[model samples]
Target: MNLDQYLPVLLFIIVGMAVGIGPLVLGYVLGPNRPDDAKNSPYECGFEAFDDARGKFDVRYYLVAILFILFDLEIAFLLPWAVALQDVGLAGFIAVLIFLAVLVVGFVYEWKKGALDWE
Candidate 1:
């Protein structure tokens, strides 16, 4: 097996590691060591932490976050499909319609369940 083909992969790994760790290394070496009460304190939403670190959070918080990611990714998929509309033709169009139908059904289900309600 020719080892030359692996040279680029090795270099890529080295560069990737350097890029990932370089900032931390430089910051630790060059940055000042400073810690104060305000800087080290737990902060939340422009205020100090009011609850315990492991306090229970409302289930709706997680539900909303998951729904946001679900809808966000589904929307992101539309960009590629739109770009390839000419190549995919009618079949792709119908597939996307079905996908959209499913998405709408899920949204409606969540809405009916009051998952979207903040209060």
Candidate 2:
């Protein structure tokens, strides 16, 4: 291994650090220092913190969050599938269909169990 091969990697690390830290330093120096009650208060899931931070949360809150993540990840698969559609051909299409079918079944199960109900 030659040092020449590592030069780009070193430059990339330096650039990444600059990109990450530059805006943060600039914001601290240039942004307004306006803090109020709302800004200082602890917020949880868009609601004001009412109970002990470590206390149990409603199971539905976690269920809804998990459902959102599940669908979000499913949609993420579409990007790669779309890119490789021609390469994968019909088998990929069928595999995605099967994946969607399983998701729909889980969705129906959750719906029947009232996991989606707000109350």
Candidate 3:
């Protein structure tokens, strides 16, 4: 088979690699060499790193993070549904309504259990 068919793909790969690596190489070559104590120090924050990196955190951190991801991804479904609203008609509308109902129920459950309370 002729390799001409793959010319665009080869060019795309080369360009993609250049775009990804060019900035990194340029930064290493041209960036400042300043490395003072504050810059080089293990600064987790202005405050010292109190907790061990591997220390067991309270489950609330994971719970909050998972909840954020869940709601964030739930919104992602809206774009496709909005685009295909006419094609999907009533069935799609009802399906989304049911999905929303379940989400609300879960939210209520979490609220009742005080999982959403900060303090």
Best by TM-score: 1
Q: Candidates' lDDT values, in order?
A: 0.90, 0.89, 0.86
Counting only residues 3 or more apart in sequence or on different chains, how many pairs clash (N, Cα, C under 3 Å) in candidate 3? 0
Cα-based TM-score, every candidate? 0.66, 0.61, 0.62
What is the C-alpha lDDT profile of model 2 across 1-119, one tens digit per residue? 77999999999999999999999999999999997887867676655665467877778788889999998999998889999999999999999999999999999999999888885
Candidate that beats the other on lDDT, 2 or 3, i.e. the better one:
2
Supply the TM-score for candidate 2: 0.61
- Sort order, TM-score high to low: 1, 3, 2
Expressed as tens digits, the lDDT of each residue in 19-110 for candidate 3 is 99999999999999896776656563333444467766678878999999989878898779989999999999999999899999999999
Q: Which sections of candidate 1 miss by over 4 Å? A: 1-22, 25-51
Cα displacement (angstroms), candidate 3, residue 92, comes to 0.6
Candidate 3 segments whose C-alpha is farther than 4 A from its true place: 1-48
Worst 10 residues of 1 by lDDT: 42-51
